[model samples]
Target: MSIDANKELVRRLVEAINRDDAAAFEALVAPEFLLRDAVVPTPRGPAGFREAAAVFHAAFPDFEETAEDVIAEGDKVVLRWTARGTHRGEFLGVAPTGRVIGFSGMAVFRVADGKFVESWQCHDRQGMLRQLERAAACEGGGGR
Candidate 1:
């Protein structure tokens, strides 16, 4: 696909994420989509991707994702994004703290046949953990 098309695909991905639509997300991904990220567990594929989305949506029902920057070169696209939402459910073993939080992330996707096939991502997990901890501390739960 062309560079603009690749960038458009990434933009749609951000929309799907903000909407928390798994079917919409799956439509843009290849059948054998692979996710490579340190925070995510192994055996990652489209289903795993959907599961991760579910987890996030469960924690932050009103989660909104915005693409701050998008760059495309050949079949690869790099996306920098930020998400904000209120924590109302569990996230990565952290209990709900009812705190509004924001985090940034960057991901590079490889597209083929007009669909995302592979991705490598890095997100601010430590920063999110710190916010959660601080919220807990404020609630007398004792944070590190």
Candidate 2:
């Protein structure tokens, strides 16, 4: 696929995540898709993506990610994005504190055959955790 098309594929991925669209995830991801990210436990295939998305949605029901920039070259696409959400469910052992949080991240994807073959994601996980911690403290609770 062309570089622009590959970039679009990633953009659609962000859209799918915002919509929590599982079918789109299946369509955009290759059967052998691989993920490199610390926030998720199991990091392989479309099911992994779905699980990660579910975790985020469970913790932050209003989660939304916005792509700030997208760049592509030689079968690789990089996306810089910002995500915001309200904590409503437990996450990473942290109990829900009903606090809104935002963080920025970037993901680099290797695309082939019009689908994502592999991706490496880096985001402000610490910031997310810290915000949740503060909210927990304010509410007289703690991470579980």
| Residue-by-residue lDDT tens digits, candidate 2, 24-142 | 99999988888888878666788888888888888899999999999999999999999999999998999888889998999999999999989898999899888989989988854
Candidate 2 matches the true fold with a TM-score of: 0.94
Using TM-score, give the best candidate's number.
Answer: 2
- What C-alpha lDDT, on a 0 to 100 scale, does residue 70 get in candidate 2? 99
Clashes of each: 0, 0
List per-candidate RMSD values in Å: 1.8, 2.5
Per-residue CA lDDT of model 1 for 1-144, tens digit only, reads 899999999999888878777787678888788888777664555676777677788999998889999999998999999989898998878888899999999999999998899999999999988887787677775745
* Candidate 2, lDDT over the whole model: 0.90
Q: List the candidate 2 regions with Cα displacement exceeding 4 Å.
A: 141-144
TM-score of each: 0.92, 0.94
Q: What pairs collide in candidate 2? A: none
